[model samples]
Target: MVDKDATAAVSRSEEGDFVKSTWEVTVTSPEGVRHFPVYRTILKVPPVVLRLVQGELHFESALEVLHRREPVASGVLAVGETLRCGDWELSLHDRSGKSRAVLECFTDPFYSRIWTLHEQVTRVGRPGKRENELEIDHPTMSREHAVLSWEERGPVLRSSGRTWVDGVAAAETVLADGALVQMGDLLFQFRLLSELVLARGGLCVTSLGSFQARVHGELVTEKAWRTQAVRWMLARLALEWGRPVAVERLLDEFWPEMPEDKSRNNFNYTISTLRQVLGGSEAILRATGSLQLSPSFLGSHDLVALQRTLRVEDWGAAVELYGEYLPGCYLDWAVAMRGSLEQQVLQGGLRLLERYEASECWPEVLELGGKLHAIDSTCQRTALGVLRAHLGRGNASEGVRFYERFREHLGVELAMEPSAELAALAEQARGG
Candidate 1:
């Protein structure tokens, strides 16, 4: 029997096979959060089929599962792109305006398959007992219909039978990054790893400062969001970025107090609104029982970009990018990420400040030191660095003034004085 007041939730497990997935079932109540693992065949069970039966979850296989497959690129995907093996017609495009291809069959919309083209030469044709790079079982497809090859220009398609690129019949066409190719009656999207990276005009998430989402460099204002839930939903999705977040987890997080059925409905509604705000369904990538932001659409994210910039020793640019993560977002997940990012920048700034001071780059040192001090006012090293920077720049009076404020701050905040080393630096500033 189940507790009448308890709410049941399902979270995805890290491990799963093609046919079976282990889901962690959490039941939350006044007693506390208790749970168990439930196993379901991925092919047979959809996340929607779980229901409460006599106080426990009854997992029944749906009559027909929309057997979707998302195929990810075999090679390193572009910076903002995440390709998964799944059946989705992601209307992602490169700068040239050609749709980025994720191969899929149009006949069965519910049972579509997506494949990543990784090979130099890929043969496409009708399915047989023999294996081919891509196989279409349609009657219009020949045994060997078309061949795709990576060339100096890009992915080029050559057809032995009737084929079309972007609806026009063609013998050969250089696939524009993401081009829809029709071989006989079967249509497939063709793409290359190189093209996805080079593709331009995608989403840019700026969370390090004010929370802003820009699609193709155009800002998505607060008024654009239909609801606060929809806005936060995008924030959560963008925060996870490349990682696929479980749908069940989202339902629990977003509306734990609401009934399970109501939460699911709301979740679906939120996704619909988010899709509209993001431009299309392709902006959100769907995997098996999970969702992720489309990598192709995510052209630039300040948090991700800032880390990359820091890695390349672009300290100034990194500092410029650093801001409170999701400024007004007080959600638990947002707060946690904000703390981690703040620490990362604080540590990086300290290192850069040391390097600048060693090179006698006082202006850079002062800029970095002030930022680091703001992030961690209690740090004696930062205070000392700031003083030295001012002294180095021949601004002795300013250094003394800053030291006096720092001393007072330490006394009031911690009931302590500046460290001996920091005090000595302050003395030098005072003497000058």
Candidate 2:
């Protein structure tokens, strides 16, 4: 039996709009016990839970029931309890506890398994049978290996016997997102779900063009770093987001002219001021004698996102991320970083243009080529790409116009004539 009013309340919640909520659950099948993250809407009226496993969704039947004699609100499920709906049953656990987090294992024997960290201390080793939270039965693995526990700052992993982080032998280290953890022959990638959730909707630093930070899609002008010192500091930090930047290195790079003692004091003051501007001291952390911008405070950053898309071979998205890198900033470091990113964008754009040309995707090639030309007006390769894309589409007039503009740009900027290849392309377009 259930309370009709409570049931009606839950029904109303389901009928309303949807909001994102994350959950950790375990599903037992004939193969074994598997754990994963479940993203569900605020309303639980459908009595179904959606599980995301390696970016794929699995629809599993679920039920809403009273837990501890209290009505289970929409999007709210009790921790450490198993509920049955239809033929499927799942045990839910709270992942937002003070010390709770999740570790996703990607090695064989337990690939795609999500390990819930609930206790103050949990161990990772090659346990006999079903003994450990994470078990890897390999010849290279020791019986009792590493320990994972929560610290005030974040989660930390310490090797009890033999373990490695990113191919380096480490006794203890603070776990970072995408860190490769190796024990024996088994390797796993670590991601803090708490950090991921915190990063869902927050400040977004756009560094591809002019540097700016936005909160919830709105520009944060009040906290903008106006001074050169503060602006450079924030730029450097954003460039190395999710990693620590040493104080000595920052001082050497940004303020080498100042004396050591004075520079240190000034750096300290700048850090304090930055924290105040960010609206919280926790946004910047001073740990292990280095500074780290909290990943939780970052929603999206163009540079980081561009690198990710490039890694995945997503040319369209990579092209979209391509823009003027740190425009109008004349600092030496900014100039160097900008040049490096420009080269990367050019190479990526050329690759995409070649692919599109092969597929006869003239419109896409034109779009990408035009963007590349805008970024580097004197780039002959980009000009050729645009001209060819136009010609392929039979837009001879547009191709001639592009060639004329490119020729003019070359003459004005370099005081040189267009290359033979470019001149031939324009001649062919005019003849056509």
The best candidate by TM-score is 2
Q: Against the correct fold, how does model 2 do in TM-score?
A: 0.61
lDDT of 2 by residue, 300-411 (tens): 6778767655554555566677777788777777899888877877787788788788898889888888888776789888788888889999999989998998898799
Per-residue lDDT tens digits of candidate 1, residues 292-318?
A: 765445556667766654554455556
Positional deviation of 430 in candidate 2, in angstroms? 2.6
Q: What are the TM-scores, per candidate, against the unseen true structure?
A: 0.56, 0.61
Give the C-alpha miss distance for residue 350 in model 1, angstroms: 0.8
Per-residue lDDT value at 171 in model 2: 93
Q: Whole-model lDDT, candidate 1?
A: 0.62
Candidate 2: Cα lDDT at 223: 43
In each prediction, how many residue pairs overlap at the backbone (N, C-alpha, C within less than 3 A)? Answer: 17, 0
